[model samples]
Target: MSHHSIEARDLAFSYPDGTVALDGVSFEITHGESVAIVGANGAGKSTLLMHLNGFLTPLRGSVRVGDVPVIKSTLSDIRKAIGTVFQDPDDQLFMPSVYEDVAFGPMNLGLPLEEVDARVIEALTQVDALRLKDRPPYRLSGGEKRAVAIATVLAMRPNALILDEPSSNLDPRARRRLIGLLGTFTHTKIIATHDLDLAMDLCERTIVMSGGTISADGRTGDIFTDDALLDSCGLERPLSMQNCPKCGRSD
Candidate 1:
């Protein structure tokens, strides 16, 4: 599915105040690939993702979702192919009930009521959240909100998923649940997160960004094992890869 692949060419962007967020960054993510974008707080991980679905336009360079350019004229169609789940579930879930929130996207697409209903059921079922369909978003536990937020995106049936900090703010069980949920998606996934363990679990490939540019891009294991490299990027080995307190640090 070449049409589902994403590519960025020489991407460069600067904020209004003249802060360079990305500088000549470029990469390609093939269809069905789950890729992790990792970096420090201001490393430009978020900025790079914003350009994928036309949430932000590049000052110089181009991004293409398959054959479609991520430009103003193609935004509507592009959005239909890419569903983004923001870091905060509250940002995506605003309807009174879980059902409405899941149905919102397909409904906006002018789908028939029957089709929308089918989609909501399928999405909620996928997340194993059918039981919470009637609950208010605000009333949900952090994990519940995360599941529903993802369901809202799944309901749209996009070929790719863009998640910004999908594991953020969740308790251990909630985070593990989120990881399991995401592991089941066949769609192309581009996740921006500080959750190195999640990256290790879900992605085969990883891109490390620094100062608005990529410092490393390779298999997740190779990238994560390089202590000096990760340390330079303001990160450390994931807990799973670390030595135990009595074992001392592993090489």
Candidate 2:
């Protein structure tokens, strides 16, 4: 088995309108590592996550999850290994009931019915949404809906968890809960978000994206301390008053 969980080599993509999203981006995420991709709006963060799961094919180069390449012939297999959660919960959760939404991926994978049921229950429990399993997805609060969306992907037990703006639109309490839940998972985690506070708390490493390419990749503490670099990327330095649990050091 390969040591790297995800590898992108000289990847590039352009939209139908000739707008470039990713420009020869290359990086590798190691197994069991927690990484945050930080960038301003339209920095190609979401575009990169799409390539990780084969949702968007690169106009050039390639993306690989473990030993499997994210090509058309292997897209399904690659998706099974990497569960991607979009920034908006509504984009991911469309089923009527929470249970059904969480069960969708497992069912699509053709797991046995009983196994799927068990996975659904486990996933809901993971996100502390077991009590809302039968509730209508539309009725849940923003935080609740986001939890369900995460549960939907977790039910498949993907090898790597790729979350885009996982803490977006969440209240402080909800954000704390989400972070706690993420801390329990041991899989390789890649999160793309502008929430530098959350990234400092959760990720050991941070990759800075700008103009469709990675501008910096290093320890989270090192990246956050550089004011000039943060300014260049249109990101503010993480507040000096905040405490980061992962580093066991507070500013």
Candidate 3:
């Protein structure tokens, strides 16, 4: 892969139970772009993210990260370029301590101990979780775990970051902090979420999916403002775009 740009071309997938997850979904995300995929439950947002990182392969189409295609033989290379942070922090953090969890990726790659230690410290510092290094991940609060989970991915030094429902189960302050943390990164980010407000805050481009296909792809502001489009796909205007109930003002 090169520059970490992502591309999905005419992709299609079906679950083992014969439920269709994606059908003819296609989009190209350029390097360093922040893109959001938003839709209702069962709209296939998570499935698509999984395909990008090779966690699930498309039955019919293909995905490319930069120039590298996501195939079984290149799975390692693909994963190395694309770091995925799943919807649940618990699914990610399992090591005894935050430091060990963050160091796991680099260690698995057989890097020198010095390199692994440096990477662990760097990743933790980036997520503002260095102070939590020696603590057990299971003992952390929701926000701390979220930060540490992100630190785990950052340690891999992936070119593009894929996150699913990253703001779920967080308090307002924690959500705000997550947003600020994500904004500081220069790498490409593709976020799948129900949180339109977070999408508006982080993504410049938004893709709307419905029935396992892309219904719309455009500017985040344009997509959020289109009430009919959102309604058709079971979405609502972001809170920032909606008029306030108290004073009838829109952000």
Candidate 4:
């Protein structure tokens, strides 16, 4: 079997208005690895995440999940293997109730009703949102909504998870909870975010995108330590913090 869980080769994308979003970007993520895609706004982080699950077909080159090429004919398979959480939970969690939103994926996957129910419960529990199952998604706090969105995708049991700004708009406590929750999942993960600290804490590797192309890819520590490259890509170095008795040091 191939070692790569997801692979992109010379990928390129353009908007309808003719703005290029990705240009010849390529990389491979192994199974169960956690990777962060970091860049400034409009650097194509969201566009790259969309390509992983076949939401957006490439204008040139290719993307593969497992060994399956992400094309029109294989879109369904690719999507089933990769779960995506958008930057805004409002965009992802549209069902009236939290339970319904979490159950949506499994239900669409054609699982038995009982199995779907079980999956939803398990997913919500994993994200610590089971208590909100009966609540309307619109009523949840920002962090709760984010957790619910993640639970919705988790219910489908995808092999890989693609998250856009997973910790955006969250308070410190909520952000820590989210980081801990994500750390428990074993699937391959590709996180697109501007939060350098979150990336440093959660990902082993980092890929820097600028002008729609991957300019740097390396160990998280190495990438974060390169001040010059980070500046060139319009990224800031992760904040240095003193060790705390409770949490060691800030990530």
Clashes of 1: 0
lDDT of each: 0.94, 0.90, 0.93, 0.90
> lDDT by residue for model 3 over 146-250, one digit each (tens)?
999999999999998999999999999999999999999998999999999999999999999999999999999999989999999999998888999899977
lDDT tens per residue, model 4, 1-251: 24547889999999999999999999988899999999999999999988887889899999877778898899887787788999889999999999999988898899999999999999999999999999999999999999999999999988889899999899999999999999989889999988889888889999999999998999999988888999899987776522465777665
Runs in model 3 deviating more than 4 A are none
- Selected candidate, larger TM-score, 1 vs 4: 1
Pairs with steric clashes in candidate 4: none
Reference-based lDDT, residue 202, model 4:
88
Question: Which candidate tops lDDT?
Answer: 1
**lDDT against true structure, model 2:** 0.90
Candidate 4 overall Cα lDDT vs. reference? 0.90
The residue ranges of model 1 lying beyond 4 angstroms of the native Cα positions read 249-251
Give me candidate 1's TM-score against the actual structure: 0.97
Distance from true position, residue 228, model 4, in Å?
A: 0.6
Q: What TM-score goes with each of the models? A: 0.97, 0.93, 0.98, 0.94
lDDT of 3 at 5: 74
- Summarize candidate 1's per-residue lDDT along 1-251 as a digit string, tens digits: 24788999999999999999999999999999999999999999999989998989999999999998899999999999999999989988999999999999999999999999999999999999999999999999989999999999999999999999999999999999889889999999999999999999999999999999999999999999999999999999888899877868664
Instruction: Supply every candidate's count of residue pairs whose N, Cα or C atoms clash at under 3 angstroms.
Output: 0, 0, 0, 0
Using TM-score as the yardstick, the better of models 1 and 2 is: 1
TM-score of 3: 0.98
